[model samples]
Target: MSIDSIDAAPPATAQTEQAVREQALVEEVIRSFASGGSDRDREVMNSLVRHLHAFIRDIRLTEDEWSKAIGFLTRAGHITTDTRQEFVLLSDVLGASMQTIAVNNEAVGDATEATVFGPFFVENAPQIDIGGDIAGGAAGEPCWVEGTVRDTDGNPLPGARIEVWEADEDGFYDVQCSDGRTAARAHLFADKDGRYSFWGLTPTPYPIPYDGPVGQMLEHYGRSPIRASHLHFMVSAPQKRTLVTHIFVDGCKYLDRDSVFGVKESLIKEFAAQPAGTPTPDGRDLGGREWTRARFDIVLPPAGPSTATATKTS
Candidate 1:
């Protein structure tokens, strides 16, 4: 063969050159967002581009896979409604929601740990006073919950707003009911001493809304969609950080395998079971039915910028 013809052959470095070209494309996309936007927006987009490209490259993603992902996201968007948030469920099942919470809520002093804010929180929940019933006729074994809202320094945060919600024993939130029945959720305020009490329901394990795109993803990954038994709480005071968390049932079987990856050991509390005819804390009649009670004292961290402080265990 002629020397010129031999020298024109492709070199063994062709694959490496191809990778460089691919990475150049990634950089080009990132630079498109680098200008003309706010600093934070640019930062987020650049990071997202870099990480997303790395993921695709790492998996050597195929065109079929990319198409399937696009379809999955489109279906998620289609299924979302005012009452149902499929995208939040997607983030929850992937542990993204909990990771974001961990980044924003630093462990300061004895402050309560935060967890995933599930897809069921609603605005303008009915207001109840301390020692009032919040179940709102939800069906379940009655549970009496009492707690004191205090700062990390142990100062009572009286008048703190406490919002609580949970699934009924049948494993459905009020918003999920077909008849638009409002139950199993309410809001109340702390008393003068930062103490609050309300009658709710003993939480039960429930699968997140399945039969959706998120559910199909979980099924494909061989993951369960059932979350641990718990009651959701969002507590806030004037000068304190708003805390979104859950007090899990200590003995729940799903605690270790919570679908949303939201179970924190410090957030688990024992729900003391009471027999029939037991004296209630507020002297309410249960009519010869068994009940349970739980106490969850919440300590709020101060409102401030996000920190990376190590979490303190209770």
Candidate 2:
């Protein structure tokens, strides 16, 4: 029989009657959110209810599973702190952060691709010179990174601001410092020629804070928590889009399976090995140990009238 005929004869049995009642209950719950405070709030709440209800129905989810999910969220919140953000970590592991970035920051021309703005970024990094060091007493092999910023039309952007931060050789950011001292982070400005360089540590593969509830979720699915070796950059120039991105260490073991799925082929850069005793760009002697060099160029798109100052830097 056709769906129209099938629906016409539906609520005769007790089971059918109960099913109809349940369907009406779900609809009423969804509709109740229509009067939320603002249009955006109403839209968000209404859509959330619809999708959530549909999911609950599709899975025929048990009350036990629902309670477990709530408990997981509670634990995530409990573990969150000024130093740690379990929620962002959870979103990153689930690919939702990357997906949201892809949706909102669609690539324009040769503009640099953005990854997660990760929860680690701190405003007001100490400013340094164009070729100064950001290691700040952190322990690791020195790496030289130089890059240029330009517009989509290839015009150089002088005085662009660049902020950089990364983990030490052991894979912990400055904010995660056990001694409560900042390290491996700084800000600098581009030169008149649109070039900026700095001394940083060659990034090493590190595991995310896997001692939390998010980690438990990953463990439940048998997923590794290792992120690829990389350096983070937040570049901004006047009249250009602010670009938040990273350059992955070429040949890093986790490149193929970054825990947060942040790796992009174009963002991978080779950290060239330099022999010991080589002279550095800023005229410093390399001394005994071999050093590494990586260069990443950023291209930003016009920010239009909405974007404000890009005046801060390294």
Over 4 Å off, model 1? 1-14, 307-314
RMSD of 1: 7.4
Clashes of each: 0, 5
Q: How close is candidate 1 to the true structure, as a TM-score?
A: 0.92
- TM-score for all models, in order of appearance: 0.92, 0.89
Give the number of the best model, judged by TM-score: 1
Residue range 1-314, candidate 1, lDDT tens digits: 44223323333444777777777788799778777789998877877777777667666788999999999999999999888888888888877888888889988999999987777888899999888888888899999999899999999998999999999999989988889888988999998899999999999999998899999988988999999999999898887888988999999999999999999999999999999999999999999999999999999989889732322110
Across 1-314, the per-residue lDDT of candidate 2 in tens digits comes to 43233223333333766657656776698678766689988776766665666556555678999999999999999998887888889889999878766765667887888876777788898999988999999989999999898999999899999999999999888888667787899999999989999999999999989998989988999999999998988898877778778899999989998988999998999999888888787887766888899999999889854332322111
lDDT for model 2 comes to 0.82
> Where does candidate 2 stray beyond 4 Å?
1-19, 304-314
